[model samples]
Target: MTQQTLQRPSGWIERSRPAVQWTALIGLSLGFGAVLFWLGVPAAMLIGPLLAGIVISGNGGKLRLSRHAFVPVQGIIGCMIARMLPSSTGGELGIHWPVFAAGVLSVIVASGILGWVLVRMRVLPGTTALWGVSPGAATVMTLMAEAFGADAQLVAVMQYLRVLMVAAIASVLAKVVGANPHHAVAAVTWFPAIAWLPFAKTLALAVLGPLLGQRLRIPMGPMLVTLVAGVVLVHHGWLSIELPRWLPAIAYAFVGWRIGLRFTRPLLAHAARALPRIIACSLALIVVCGAIGAVLVAVAGVDPLTAYLATSPGGADSVAIIAASSNVDVRFVMAMQMARFLAVLAIGPATARFLARRATANANAAAAAAASSTDS
Candidate 1:
């Protein structure tokens, strides 16, 4: 009998140590922290990096301008809207079913239109474009789109880019309107060091949730899991973690930086050919959705502007932040936005794929007919 000996190769373990993984993590954390510090002194609400990293690496890019640019703008908008809402829930126009319905309808229409535009312009595959334009949870939309055969990477890029854009734009608008916004509530400073016990639990859930989601083949993976886990923890009172005051702003800045980096010459050249149609469709979608939202607001007897912002196909977090800052019924707007997002996350990709397939079939049929006629 002969015995065989197997020798391990050198540096095999080192080589397998997760390529370029730390780059995004370290960069996101440091960048977010720096932004937070610049916004204020020693604000511990620095979890922006965790969220931003999810957005950056999720798209296989370190950063992109489109995604990074929108976050702060959206945050400012969210803050302004939040201010508009009644400090106490016992106001004349309470959060009701009508408000919810209007918000949901607005998001659905806006997101659908945006998706269609992207598909027609070929900036992204139809399915991916649909999910990318959705104003709901980006991670959730990404996962669902993947299940429906959408391009996950493209969806991640689009969703994050929208967030960055919305955030940036909203912030500017808020500033213009003379709205004073609160920094993101720092997680560390809000309750004390021991407050993290609940956050740790929520984080554990976030980690486990993503793993489970991935095993289930969820699209946006960890990001969606973390969002859902955070919401649930908050709702359940098991975790009372507050975001740092500058967290949203800093997070958004990181998102903007990432998105801005995507503007390379080649990408821009491709966009140039397609940008007109894409912009047209996107604008059309926004108008239609905005109209719908305005009508709903009127019917619900709520402030039209808040409804408009909530229903806008921008981004949930951005809208949430706007609603928060502007006193615009943050819960209602955020809830509706989340709902619409869920709908898009669930159905947008399937709808886009269906449309794409139909277009392809029609083109093929037309080509076949032309050939037959020539032969005849």
Candidate 2:
């Protein structure tokens, strides 16, 4: 009877372990997210939960966010992106295709050069550096990094770090140039009056899109499928994607935690040591992108503010917010941003692979020369 009592208690504790861990994970995510939001950090909702997951994982938390939850979250994020890019933006691009093409190419080439430099310097190991500085959507790049054999954790660090820095510089510059705060888009209410039919349609897309994408075996299939379909549907006025604030918050938190929880102590330590170099690379990229923006101002005959926001090496969503709050041409800013995003998506993977191979070859030749010298 005594033995049975002890065993039963042990079993009970074992069963309760997951529940306890989950509770802690949720609590930490919310707390960190709130603080970051208060601090006006860009992507705070995503970064907060990521930081929380890092803390949990560092302290031996074993629980993870499931793939089932993650794929749909990607769909929601895809929808969020679609909402920002309007059909008018495409028309704007059509008007100034040459200028837009040149600007986008310049930014991408600059990013590639920086990425190659990182590989040559051995800042981050392998082709991870290439993926890190792809100049694409930060979240999408991070999500796709693992599939390409890059270290997703390190890529996340580089991508988000660059994002935070770029957003900060853009915001301060906007304020300095007298951007009108009143022009900012209205904040969405979390529990707004729901249009059930439209909301249901959105839910349906979010669920079915990913499933079909996975079945098709496309790279980052879920997100790509949802992004394409959402854009087409919304652009045509055939669908209205109604995502309340809380819905996206939940999605961001899930993606963040999924990445963050996989971090090990060694990985965290490595990231800490590489922090300074990472910061330098991020700043350098921003400066280079700023140079690109200046070129746009001179050649495209646009205002400095519009040029800067248009060529900013940050997330489109963050840049959009800054552009909207300013007196700049919002359509032009978004158009340029979208054009660059599409360009990156089309060419980023192949370029990253090519540059990575070159970096590796260069490293190998250098190592061989060093060995020959040592033998002599």
List, residue by residue over 102-157, the lDDT tens digit for candidate 2: 89999999999989888777877776777888786666767766876678878878
User: Over the full model, what C-alpha lDDT does candidate 2 score relative to the true structure?
Assistant: 0.74
- Please state the error at residue 274 of candidate 1 in Å: 2.1
TM-score of candidate 1 relative to the true fold: 0.55
Per-residue error for 204 in candidate 1, Å, reads 9.6
TM-scores of the candidates in the order shown: 0.55, 0.69
Candidate 1's displacement at residue 80, Å, is: 15
- Per-residue error for 332 in candidate 2, Å, reads 6.2
